[model samples]
Target chain A: MFRDITIGQYLPGESFIHRLDPRTKILSVLFFMVGIFGLKHLYSYLFVLALTLTVILVARIPLGYLLKGLKPIFIILIFTVGLHLFLTPGQILVEIGPLSITLEGIMKASFMALRLIFLVLFASLLTLTTAPMSLTDGLEKLLAPFAKVGLPAHELAMMMSIALRFIPTLIDETDKIMKAQKARGADFESGNIWQRAKSMIPILVPLFVSAFRRADELAMAMEARCYRGSEGRTRMKQLVYRKTDLIVTLGMGSAMVAAFFFL
Target chain B: MIKIDNVIHTYKKHSDEEVQALCGISLDIQEGEFLVIIGHNGSGKSTLAKHLNTLLIPSEGQVLIDGLDSTDPDMVWNIRSRVGMVFQNPDNQLIATTVEDDVAFGCENLGIESGEIRARVDDALATVGMAGFGNKEPHYLSGGQKQRVAIAGVIAMRPKYLVLDEPTAMLDPRGRQEVMETIHRLNKEEGLTIVHITHYMEEASQADRVVVMEDGKIVAQGCPREIFSQVKLLKSLRMDVPPMTELASILNEAGLEVDKTLLTVEEMVDALC
Candidate 1:
């Protein structure tokens, strides 16, 4: 059941969007997010929604898979919509008991909800199209300039990549531990909130121990491979900006600027 | 080439209850030698292997790799680059998400150019029979495949010697065979020195030389045939001899005319026939 969650999952595909450089995809998402926040009118929100749909089509990600990623955020979206609906004061539209819904409130809530939805869709599209390795590579390259100012960008990126690499491994470990505990008559499901938290101790302790052992071994292996900070390290897959990347950057920049001014 | 000069390693050296992991070990590993070290758990085989790559400096003595002292702080990286080490768990050693990237890890650490790193990654992957699996995620790979990728990661650095500490201990029989074959091929075809630390007697029987450790000391060292022929000594040390060697010894004890030196089934069959 835990495997059904696919928020940061990458769906491999051969498509125009998938072929774009990771930097291009990352920058495009950034611009799209900015445009989403800048939009004041409903038409602009629809335009952004249409733009997200076009990206989804180009990436060839299955609609069902993308929607599955939004499942965890459904409650957050509902809460945002509900907060705006009841709190925003405007001309009255409906009255139910002590609650009053207004025209402006409805408009604001729907727009806010659409913005949230489009934000998630665009972000998911980026991860769906680009592999996690490329994403970290892009992040490292994008942050390389900050390293000159005493920031440990390379180390941060390395940590992120390693964390991503270990997610599935740790998940498998968790599943195994959970099953082992269950076989030993450990109840994880039948308890209050505090009791459920307490029940996790058995699983957490072993997992933490194994994780530390893995970290120690990994550190030794890395040292054996001559890893001595990021001073002189070189990457095999050098990130290069191509013609398509430039075009995508220019197009996205123009669209975002247009959304801010014209809309 | 590597030399261990009376190396004594103690864990928690400053503590009163320090445990001696390696007790007065001395050995020499020549270039292009396929040396296998076999021992029971906590016999200090891994501790000895770690000394070869400077992962653990000796508490009393010294380890020298290619004439450079492993204990010297300045030569640590140089020694590490020369003597690559692969650990038991493939999942832990593989730091990169993709196989190719992991293979490129050592080269990258050496500050090699991107083009050179790319070539080395491809060549190393091909050497490990994982040529087309460059882009595959390491998590999705089977145990055998992951170990192969880990070997590729080490070999990509073009190390003169590869020290594997029970690399196949966590693997299944198939995975063990895969890793053993890769190690042997690297030693034979590439002329790379291999210091393989393993618990499998069959693996040790195939090595050019075998060193048996007991209680953090070398109990015996000889060719596989000579080593396995001493079935009583090996058994006394709580280590198993090769299956064929054990069977041959049993047959010989039963008044049958069998060669106790046989390390493989084929050799046993020839001796019987």
Candidate 2:
């Protein structure tokens, strides 16, 4: 069941968006998300939505796969929309027995929902286009200036990339452990909420132990490989910006500027 | 040459119940030699291998690699770079997502230039016969392939000595054979000195010299023929000889004219025919 979750997953492609520098994609997504929130008019939101759609089109990711990522957030989206619909005090449009829906509430809820949808899509697009390793590299490069202020940018990047790399591995290990526990007559389903959470102890204990063991062994291996706190370490694949990155950054900048001025 | 002089390693030395892992082990590993250390569990073989790469300093004596002391604070990185190590668990050792990136890890740690690192990475991958697999994810590779990638990672550092602690212990027979062949090729063609620690007697049979440890001390050390010939001593030490060696020894004791020193099946077949 955990396999169906598509967040933090990368889909490899040869599209223009995929070929762009990871920094470019990351900055574009950030700018787009901020611009999406700055828009006060429906026309600007529509423009942002169109821009997101164009990026998805250029990325060539299947629309079905992209929508599949939203499955888990469906309930949260509905709750937000519902909360906005009932709470916003405005001119009533539709009346229920006790609760009344108003024009302002409908408009506010739809806009908020659209913003949420666009936020998820833009973030997912960045991950979908760039590999996690390059994403961490981009983050490290962007944060390098902060190193003078006692920030451990390299270590942070390394930790993030390692965590990303181990997600699938840990998931597979969890699945194996769950099956092993199930074979021993452990039931994770068909129980009360507290009972189910309690039953997870058997799985959690071994998973934590194995993770600690792996971490220890990995630390030893890293030390044996001459890793001394990432000092003077050079990467094999250096991140460099291309003309395409400049073009995309400029285009995104102008779009955000346009949203700020006209909206 | 690597030298171990009166080396003694103990775990939890400050505790009241100190366990001595290695007790006064003195040995010299010659340059370009394929040396295999065989022992049962808790026999200090792995502890000794870690000493070679300075992963663990000795509690008593010292390990000198090319005249550089292993315990010296300043020479720690130098020792590690000179003696690369491949651990048992490939998954734990492989830190990168892709094969090529993992191979380049050691060089990157060494602060090599990107152009030189690329050339070294490609060369090391080709050395391990993992060419054209640069873009492949390590998790998707087979056990043997991942181990080879680990070896390639060590090779990229251009270390003079390669120390592997039961690299094939977690692999299937085919994977074992693949890793062994890679190690052998690297030793023969590249002239890299190897210090392999394993429990597999068959793997020990192929080494240029074998050292058998029983209780944190070397019980026997000699060529394969000389070591496997003493079947009774090995049996008393709770270690197994190669299957052919055991069979030949059993046959010799059964009033048959067979050489107990035969370590391979082909040699037994020829002797019997």
Candidate 3:
């Protein structure tokens, strides 16, 4: 159930998109985002929409899962549309209670809303296809050059991976702690917002204490394994780009660029 | 061989008050032998294990892994690589999400090449009887499997001496049994020197040597039969003997003809017949 929080979660599959190198997927997403932000005409938006849908279809991610990921951002989407529709000054289309809707406002709001939706879709699509480990590996390699600039590329990547690894563990621990507190007649539900907030303290205290203890033990175990830092480390999984990865990444990048500049 | 020479560790509790965790302790862990350390909590069983791998430096004295001193700044990694440690909790030790990656963690940290790391990971996984579970996530594993994975992670470093500190303490009975068998197999089949620490006397009874600790000192050291035969002394130190040994002691006290040195259920069965 904890894993069913589909936002930024991987859906294991053997689709064409899923098999692509994580670096390829990440770069394509970046290219599409840049193209989307620069597009001016409506046809380009339509082109980008069709291409996103095609990519998602190739990725074979269920429509329901993508929609679920967008649920948390629905309010933000609506707010963006509303603010642009009412606050922009232009040739008036309608007015209600000191708020005027204009022709330019209508165009602006639609584009803004479409932009937000496309951003969410592409971002979730990236995470949906790539396993968290692969994503972090790709990131570490991509960021490796920045190490000389004092970036700590490997450390950052390691932190990201370790954070992902512990998510399920922490969720289970939180569940256990909550149940233990509830068994002691501690109420977590059927309370006011403030009361519910207060009820969480009992769970938080023990969770923090145990998490710190785990951290201490983990550090010692790591030291025992001869882990000093990322200075001389080598990974088991190497990110290699295949023929399909190259073709797909190039195709997607150029298509987005074409849509943005020539559509 | 791992040699601990007069290791005295004084742990700072709030800086002002200090508790001596390991008091002038010296022990020789010979090559290819199964040695188990049994003690109650705060009896410095873990502290002694930690000293083996340089996780805790001796306040005064020395620890040497195959003639490399743990106190030497340059030899820390060498000492650690020679004496790999597996801690009590399996959940906390695995840094990678997947089993194979976690196994390769130590090898990677040691700067082994990619091909060599892969080979070692595969070999380690097979040795732990977890070859097919390389792709499995850590959270999906049972407690025993996780501990085995942790063991795999340690052995992937190619350590000669394995030090486990209460590895089965957090496991269920089945999990504990799985871990015990795995360690025993590693000790017997691979001829790896193992220094295990546990409070479970049953587990200790199978070791080549048993070291009993009390108040930060090794009070007794001998073979399992010899160690378990002194039931009253062990009981006085708040330690338990194996069930069969305890039964033998009880039966002997009742004027029955039973050997007090019995360590296993089969032995008890034979003596009863």
Candidate 4:
């Protein structure tokens, strides 16, 4: 089931948004985040919410799946809302001894919560649509200007791409090791906290050893195939922004402007 | 072609108990030959195979792959490019999500142009009979298929020689057969030199020549029949002969006139009848 957590979490589709360049997608998501935070009123918030729903609809990603991706951070989301409600000082609307609720507190809670939710949704949209390799290429291109300052932009991108590539592999390896250990009567469930933690030792040691060995072998394999850093490297699939990318940028930019006036 | 002259390899040098992986090895491998090295655990066979690809340099002496010294820093890339290696675990060797990307990895690393890399990737995948499954994720493949993809990765580099280190050691029977057959085809049809290191006696029996190792030394080197015929010597080194050869030896002890050169079960039955 852990394999379901695809490294980039990209959902393949032929939708207009999905077909846009990853660089365009990334920039659109960044603008969406900025728009969400720029909201100064309930009308602006409403516009952002509507845009979120429209994008999700066009992308055709199941709302349930998007919510599932957010499951890990439910506690954090709740904490943010609760902290805002309790900490923001204003004309007290309700009081329970040390805890007071105000209109500004409620407003701030809604703002912060909506900001985070839309932020995650938009970012997940980028990942769900763009292939990991394309995302890395877009990132490298975006960061290419920084190479002049000794940033090692290409190497960094290569590392990210390789890491993304190995995520599923390592997960599969972990699954195999777990099954192997389980066959040998290694208890991984129905134990206290410490016992459960201790059970991971067998899994951890072998995984760590195998990871190191794989890294060594991979280095040798890379060298064998003549990998000499990112210099002089050309990709089979180059990232190129198209007319659709420009349209999407304009669409998101218009939405941001609309939100400034409407909400 | 490869030339190993007095190669000596040791691990944990200057330790109380140092491991001499290869004591002293001297051999010449011809182009387009299938050479198999068989040995028990910790017999230095894997270390020897790694030398051909320049994965490990000799502690002493020399390993020349197509006249490029393995120890020479400048020649390391040249040697490695000519001698590609495939390891035991397919998972460790695969660096891409899709089969096509995995095969392209080797070519891409070689700095080949996009068009050339794509052509080579398709050719390599087709060579291993995985053309249709190029877009599929590696996890979706069977064990044999994954190993074939690993082979395709090496093939994409278009190396003159392939050094496989116990590639089927972790595969099932079906997977082993798939990999061995592919190696056979690569050696026979493509005329690519192969240095296959494995512990399975049956797998080694298919090679043009067999080299057996024990305690960092090559104890035996000859045609498979000649090498496997010495059952007593192989047993003394804790290595096994093919099942048919063992059966022949047993029948010989029982006063049967069956030849000891038989390797496969079918051949043994023919000789016995």
Clashes of 1: 0
Which candidate leads the pack in TM-score? 2
TM-score of each: 0.95, 0.97, 0.95, 0.92
Model 3 regions more than 4 Å off: A1-3, A242-252, A255-260, B251-257, B269-273
Residue clash pairs of candidate 4 = A10-A128, A11-A128, A43-A263, A44-A263
Over 4 Å off in model 2, which ranges? B13-16, B254-257
Compute the lDDT of residue A7 as modeled in candidate 4.
42
lDDT of 1 at A96: 88
Q: CA shift at B198, candidate 3, in angstroms?
A: 0.7
Worst 10 residues of 3 chain B by lDDT: B238-247
**Which one wins by DockQ: 2 or 3?**
3
TM-score of the first chain in candidate 2 relative to the native first chain? 0.95
Backbone collisions counted per model: 0, 0, 0, 4
Worst 10 residues of 4 chain B by lDDT: B90-99
Residues B48-78 of candidate 2: C-alpha lDDT, one tens digit per residue? 9999988899999989999999889999999
Query: Candidate 2 chain B, which ten residues in sequence have the lowest lDDT sum?
Result: B9-18
Which tens-of-lDDT digit does each residue in B137-214 have in candidate 3? 999999999999999999888889999999999999999999999999999998899999999988987899999998
User: Per-model i-RMS in Å?
Assistant: 0.7, 0.8, 0.9, 1.8
